[model samples]
Target: MRGVVMYAPGDVRVEDVEEPTILAPTDAIIALSATCICGSDLWPYRGADDVDEPFHMGHEYVGIVEEIGDAVRTIEPGQFVVGSFFASDNTCEICRAGYQTSCVNREVLGTTGRAQAQRMRVPLADGTLVATPGIPSDDLVPSLLAASDVLGTGWFGAVAAEAGPGKTVAVVGDGAVGLMAILAAKEPGAERIIAMSRHGSRQRLAREFGATDVVEERGAAGVARIKELTGGLGAHSVVEAVGTQESTMQAIASTRPGGHVGYVGVLHGVELRGDDVFMTHVHLHGGPAPVRRFLPELIDLIWTRKINPGRVFDLELPIDRAAEGYRAMDERTAIKVLLRP
Candidate 1:
């Protein structure tokens, strides 16, 4: 099988690799129907995240089950399924509380060899995978794939930020996750959604996703814009989707006292000041998104065409062209890139 491998910064290649097989009874193998590069993937591609050794890349995927281990009973060969980036036992105490990403027995997909291949192994199949009601049309594949990661991460951010009726929500960053966060905030009845973005294309999409205002400023200016829009009280909820010191501080400063901050960005050299957070009195929460917890509802929404998160994929490429997909995202020429294997 051929998949993407990152040898170093700006060096992604498509190469043949060994095929995957079920090594554990809880595992299942799936032939990828669709997969995509993620913003997090750029961390190493840009040399911000160390890539000491060449390794497989990509996590978001939707595919058809080709084989199942003896312990995997719910899913069978030929069933189309979507799974979270982190494979969890789902039966663990933490998972039961809706934090599957922190499950006692969790394995991150695509660590050894990722999902950006013809086929891949999924651990804890019963707990990690969710099957569609039936095989879906090709048209629905992209949106279903988004539920595997980006969309789910955005949803978790909104939920953690307490976006709901009468709440004013602000989102930091204009990446796919941030855009989806706006969509998620809208679904929950947020009274006002403020999107921080300097890009015109992203601003347009943010408004379409229910952002009532777009602030192009950053740092203190961005915080002032949020306060101005909210009559100096600041937003009741803020979603931080960029993992940087500036973006994190902007998000924290944009929320009203006692408001919640849901940060979903994969932290890259970020260190929050304890005293600053203590003084702000903002409730901060977010880590690897518990995508499994929201997969069922998100799938139902996508299946019914109630939402179209797949619009994020402005670029699509063959799996063999995974390097181009990565470059498109790094250059900001594409919002998200979908790969067809």
Candidate 2:
């Protein structure tokens, strides 16, 4: 088996590794059909985060169930499934409360520097993986994979921001998550979706997704544009998909008083001023998206073709060339890169 490993910043490789096996009765092994690189993975790749030597990379994936442990009954071998990045028991107190990301038995895949291999073990199979109604057509694989993370993260961001009918929504970032945030806003019937974008392709996709307006400016200027478009009132909800001080400020500044701001960007040396947020009276929320909770609904949407998120992938590469995929994203040559194992 070959999996992606990053020895250090700017040093990623695909090499042979031992295949994972079901370690528990509830475990399952998946043969990855497709996997993709996430923006958050770039933080360490760019030397922004302190990643110790030799760690497995990648969290978003979709695949076939190659084997299942004895305790797993709901998911069986040969079933196509989409899994969330965080593994949860689905029976824990937190899982019952719908915070599956925080389940006491939760585990984050790939951070151990051991994910992205040809096959990987999934813990708590029944609770973490959602099977499509049947073996989906080949074209649907990427969208199904999107449900595993980006789509779910975007959905959580919109929900956290309180996007709904008659509300003005603003998204801070032009990445896949941010673009999907625009789509998420539409499902909730948001009257207006304003995406803060500087890239032409992302801005166009933002509009296609449901962005009523695209603000090319950054910082205060962008915030002002949002307010201007909303009749002196900022957006009622804002989704912060970029985890940085500037993006956080943009999210808060572009949102109306008492509005909610959902931030899901992996925080990287970013801090928010309590006094500022308090004075603004904005409701702030967000963390790792509770992807496990939305798996069923999102899977249905993908299966039905109500939304096609596969357009996010502008480049594709073999798993062996995973480093090029990472570099393409880091250099902004591709919006998102899909890797075939």
Candidate 3:
């Protein structure tokens, strides 16, 4: 089998690797038919994470079940499934509370490097993978794959920020997750959606996703635009999708006092000032998205073609062109890259 491997910063190669097998009674093996490059993958690729030599790459995947462990009864071979980036047993205490990302026995998919390979192991099979209602047509594959990560992350961001009826929402970044956050806020009946985007393409997509306004400003000016649109009150909810200090600041400033800020960017060395956050008195919550909890709902939307998240995937290439996909995203030429194995 072949998988994407990162040997050094800016060095991504698709090379032959061992195929995964069911390692536990609750594990399942999936043959990936589709996968994609995530913005988070760029962190290590850009030398931010100090990735060791020859690390396994990629987490977002949608595939077919080739085999299941002895204990896996609900999902059988040949079933098409979409899973969270992190595998969690749905019956755990935290999972029961709808926080599957913190499941006691969680296993992050693809951390073991074999994920980019043709076949990968999925632990806690019964809880992690959600089978689509039926075999989907080929066109729906990309959207279903998005549901595995970006869409789920965006939905979680909106929920964390309390985006709902009669409230104005602001999104801090224009990446795929941020675009989906716009859609997610609209789903919950948010009255007004403001997206901070300088890129014309992203801004257009944001509007299509239900953003009522697009702020082309950055930094302080951008925050002011959001506040100005909301009549100096800022937005009731803000979604932060970029992990940098500036993006976080923009998200906080664009939100009003007593509003909520949901941040899901993989935090780096940046810190939030305690005084500012305390004085703002706004709610703050977000982490690695509990994608498992939203899996079923998102799948239904995709299956029915209610939301066409596949639009976020601007580039498609064979798995062998994985490096090009990474480069396009790194250069900001592509919003998201979809790869087929």
Candidate 4:
């Protein structure tokens, strides 16, 4: 099989690799129908995160089950499925509490190899994979794929931010996750959704996703804009989708004293001051999104055409062009890139 491998910063290649097989009874093999690049993938591509050795890349995927281990029962050959980036035994105590990403027995996909390939192995099949009602049309594939990661991450952000009826919500960052956060905020009845975006294209999409206001500012200025829109009280909930010191601080500062801050960005070089947080007086929560917890509802929504999170995919290419997909996203020329294997 052929997949993406990162040898170093700005050096991505499509190369031959060994195929995957079920090494665990809980595992299943999937032939990828679709996969895509993620913002987090850029961390190493840009040298922001160390890549001491060449490794596989990509996590978000939607595919068909080709084979299942003896222990796997719920899913079978020919069933289309979507799965979270983090594989977990959903029966764990933490998973039962809706934090599958932190399950006692958890495994991250793509660490062993990339998901941007013709086929891959999924462990803990019964717990980690969600089978679609049936094989979906090609049009629905992208949106279903988004539920595997970004859509779920955004939903988690909204839930963590406490977005609901009568609440004013603000989102920092305009990436795919942030845009989907805007959509998630809307679904829960947020009274006002403020999107912080400097890009015109993103701002337009944010409005379509239910952003009532767009703040084309950053740092203190951005905080001020959010406060101004909220009559100086700040937003009741703020979703931080960019894992930068500036965006984190901006999100913390943009919330009211008693508001909540849900940060989902993969932290890059962030360190928070204790005193600063103490003064802010806001509840903070977020980590690897428990995507499995929200997959059912999100899938239902997508299956019914209630939300179109797949619009985030501004570029689509063959799996052999995975490097171009990565470059398009890194250069900000594309919001998200979809690769067909």
- The prediction achieving the highest lDDT against the true structure is 1
lDDT of 3 at 172: 88
- Candidate 4 lDDT, 245-323, residue by residue in tens: 9999999999999999999997777999998999888999999899999999999999999999998888999999989
Q: What's the best-to-worst order under lDDT? A: 1, 4, 3, 2
TM-score versus the correct structure, for each prediction: 0.98, 0.97, 0.98, 0.98
Shift in Å, residue 243, candidate 1: 0.8
Give me candidate 4's TM-score against the actual structure: 0.98
Minimum summed lDDT over a 10-residue window in model 4 is located at 108-117
- Candidate 1 local lDDT, residue 234: 88
Q: Write down the lDDT of every candidate, Cα atoms only.
A: 0.93, 0.88, 0.89, 0.92
Off by over 4 Å in 3: 110-113
lDDT of 3 at 257: 90
Residue pairs with backbone overlap in model 4? none
Task: Please identify model 2 stretches exceeding 4 Å from their true place.
Answer: 113-115
The number of clashing residue pairs in each candidate reads 1, 2, 1, 0
- Where does model 1 exceed 4 Å of error? 110-113
True-structure lDDT of candidate 2: 0.88
Off by over 4 Å in 4: 110-113
Clashing pairs in 1: 110-114
